[model samples]
Target: MGSEPGAGWEFARAAAVHSEVWVITRPRFEPLIAHALAAEPVLAPWIHPVYVDLPDWCLRLKKHHRDVYWYYPLWQRLAGQRALDLHREAPFDVAHHVTFASDWMPCGLTALPPTVPLVWGPVGGASYVPVPLLRWLGLRGAAAELARRTVTGACRRAIADRTARRAQLVVGLNDDVRRRFAGTAAVVVEPNAVVDPAARGSSGSSAPSRVRTAVFVGRLVSWKGTRLAVKALSHPAAANWKLEFIGAGPDQRWLEAEAARRGISDRVTCRGQLPREAVLAALDAADAMLFPSLHDSAPWVVAEACAAGLPVICVDLGGPPIFVRGTADGVSRVVDVGPGLPARLAVALRDSESVQRPTPSDRWSSARMPALLEAWYGQAAQFRAGRDAAGNGSSVSSEVGGLVPQTP
Candidate 1:
């Protein structure tokens, strides 16, 4: 499953462990949900999925990537109405908005009864590629970044502000997002990527080799910093590392050509897109993960890499740094984004050999999520109770309690 669906499924499973969860999602996922529930019959009674979608005509608008901006909000509006009806039938203690985890996007669930506290997020999207680093992105990628910033800025002011104000608790996916919602809501830093304990790698399973290997597991897009990785690999400091690209995109040809031009074609391999199992197998065989996404809110690959006991070397801009923060000393390297990003990354790559593999007890493990969810839900319920006791007419405060401090 992709990050969005995977996050929804994980959150639903975790939430269901404590109380009944009614997941409002697209109708297409119903079959998958049914299949998953059938496989885990014990969770069937706890999970009640409510499918809500727009008409076929409206859904067609989402055929293209850009059209999703229009389609998602409409879907949220419809889902909000459905949630209202469900709440009327049987009142809910707390409501959480999980998927479509961008903070700039408006959540229609804010329309729920004022008495019922809402937990918004594991949300992100506030992270951006620094201005000094924009030179790395080609003309088209730079233009896209500009357009994204413009849209996000407008939406944050017009939509996100209101939603944050109304939410009793806002679960930010990264420090960037937590800072964005700092005074606007009761914010907590918690990533949506949770590693399955059973899938965690055993110690020495991915033992070091004479020639170190670094794996990149996202799309081969310019904004994803694949070109940057290639440039970093060209540096003498990282000459011993062989880089493998495990995804396919428009930049694949460019990456191959660039690697050849840089005279490191022998050390670089662009292995187009692979299956999940194949990706995991590749991680098992590699020494480290290099994911320098320009402005990703959260990339599931980072958490998966950590689970595989691979040290991660990522740009210090988004969710990757947060995910790797809890790893043992030298287990992860967060390169700062600036004029010499490639050089910094090259040095980090060279140093990765001495790093330790992350254990299953790290913060990203799924085992820790149940307790976190329980605490968050309890906080939301308490916030609601306090508000009710103060009287329904009492205005909601921008700050509630249970704010988790971010590690420096």
Candidate 2:
């Protein structure tokens, strides 16, 4: 994975164990990757680290803003050059681009030789906050969503289209991307892997709380639907319950004021961003996860909340629903992102007691990712070799032969 110091590290680390991985990432991740390799001595030979220094302007720009999405193409350009250099020395098989985890951001590796099959994503770009939902957000919120869509559209151009055309296999975070890039190569959907296996076990079985407590564990961003979660508490069914927000963002003040305006401030607690352990602890104590994000592409919090055995209340769109299990059995609720969200969320909160925590499957767990990824790598390699043998091949959609579990 190209470095962003998040889920990409987990995927790269796990892939190292099963395949010869050359991580073309930023220099900042060097220390962490070194420590991880030192901890696992056997991975030392298999995983190769290649760091690329971003331009001074790029680095400064990225630091100044959260949506430095355009900077990624430049980063990938450097990575592509580095990858070509490395491939010449080692004669690599398949080239996989792991991050800048957006389908709209074309992988630089896709520009590699056609014989070197390219695997793109487990990324997302198709999901967005519906225009109808914008009214729920205030002026600033609406503007933010508009800006996001505008940028996303600007980014989805020739480069990304070409990258999609060249990929031997494209792994989408959810069906949104799969549908968007439908005619482009074989598309498979699998959300990001749950990296820490130790975090898999239940956060212990506990009796139902007399007063249900729902937790929202993402940045207090507009699209996260944090306000919707707070507004839901105003519903009579969920009025008795409290909402604990556990992250910080630009919209923190707005969320707080909204809660106050709704007269639910007494029940809402914003615990800012805490350490990983603290977040998990909060999830363990909460009865349900209120993650009604309008546009999310495989959020880690959903997996973490489920790992803690907390039922999730996510929207019926994007990646959250794909990850949330047992929707039929009430383990999770996928509410529509519209005017009725508060009421639907309230019902989910009321039924939180009956919601059953889903068992984490091996396919979705990070521990088994090495195996799953090895299979993908093998397939990608075989496809590359087969195409080379045939002299040439056309870019056409093909059946996803022998791919495991249809969804994450």
Candidate 3:
């Protein structure tokens, strides 16, 4: 029901724990995904692989780098509705979107039925938390800043007004989203929950090597600003800074050329496209993570690095910054030196003191992540059920019980 992207696999694997996951995807991934799901005990048995019927060469159309991601989900949801309609012709308990209230879920992307409750986690850039600091740091131009403020304000105001006039159930992930549409919808801010701490405990330590190496794992595009990190190494402060980029994208060749142009051919290493396991292994020996993403929704990589006990140097975006507190314990610092990226990086390079000895939090471990997600889903169900019973249009009781406070 979702695009055959890596994150879709993440959601399907997680949701498969509570519900049978019947995934509709391209024939290309049928065998590969079936194998992966079969290995995971919680995800295997209920995994149903449904073939995508297309109007001849739809896969070919998708092979073009110019393809838009929204197209496939839109087309597939339309097809899924026909199938779900047939299935419900008999009887069923419920059908869920399993994400947020998106126009792109298996049901909503096509007008299947508002009858089936759909949930969407707005992990996309649309719901991105705007950061004024990024603008100050020279991340966005004045035009971009004005556009963001104007567009976001206008759209949010319109949505807020519409939500107020309607009697509907909605849950906001944070106070910002809740307050944005406050008067319009009775939004509930079920703040993020931490899952596992005890299991996270102390991780295996990575010995410091003479070389100060950092790893950046994500798509290699112009906006990611990964080149800025490499260029920063040229600054005397970080004369010995080494980098490894492990992701595939359109701008791979361009980046290699850029590195050469900057005469940092040796400092930066580009390993375009490695398996996820290999990428995690790559993160193991690295000292820090450099993530300068231009567009991010919930940048779990920030939290993931924290859990791995790795310090990170990244542009201060609102969502990822939530988990990052500028200290040795979590994030080193969140700076608004986007255009000053080179200057700041040079400063970090020169100042050996910039690399602080971290006091890692057990909360940021992978062990807690599962528990966190589980607890969130539990609240999601309860919130929905409570609102469902509140005469069609109601807010979750402010006094309503919440998900597990802390997972052991």
lDDT of each: 0.80, 0.72, 0.50
* Backbone clash total, candidate 2: 1
Provide the lDDT at 405 for model 2.
Answer: 12
Residues 1-408 of candidate 1: C-alpha lDDT, one tens digit per residue: 577887888888888778777888887887888999999999998888888788987776567888878888887888888888877777778888887888998787877887778889899999888887787788888888989899998999999999999888899989999888898999999888877643645433334567788899988998888989999999998987999999999999989999999999999999988999889888877877888888878888888877777778999887888877855435678887777789889999877666566554355776786788889889888877687677855544422222110100
TM-score of each: 0.92, 0.88, 0.64
Question: Rank by lDDT, descending?
Answer: 1, 2, 3
Q: Which has the higher TM-score value, candidate number 1 or candidate number 2?
A: 1
RMSD of 1: 4.9
Error of 1 at 403 (Å): 20
Candidate 2, position 323, lDDT: 72
Could you give me the TM-score of model 3 versus the true structure? 0.64
Which window of 10 residues has the lowest lDDT sum in candidate 1?
Answer: 399-408
Q: Which stretches of candidate 3 lie over 4 Å from their true place?
A: 1-6, 19-28, 40-52, 83-95, 98-115, 127-209, 248-264, 275-278, 299-304, 322-328, 337-339, 345-408
RMSD of each: 4.9, 5.2, 7.7
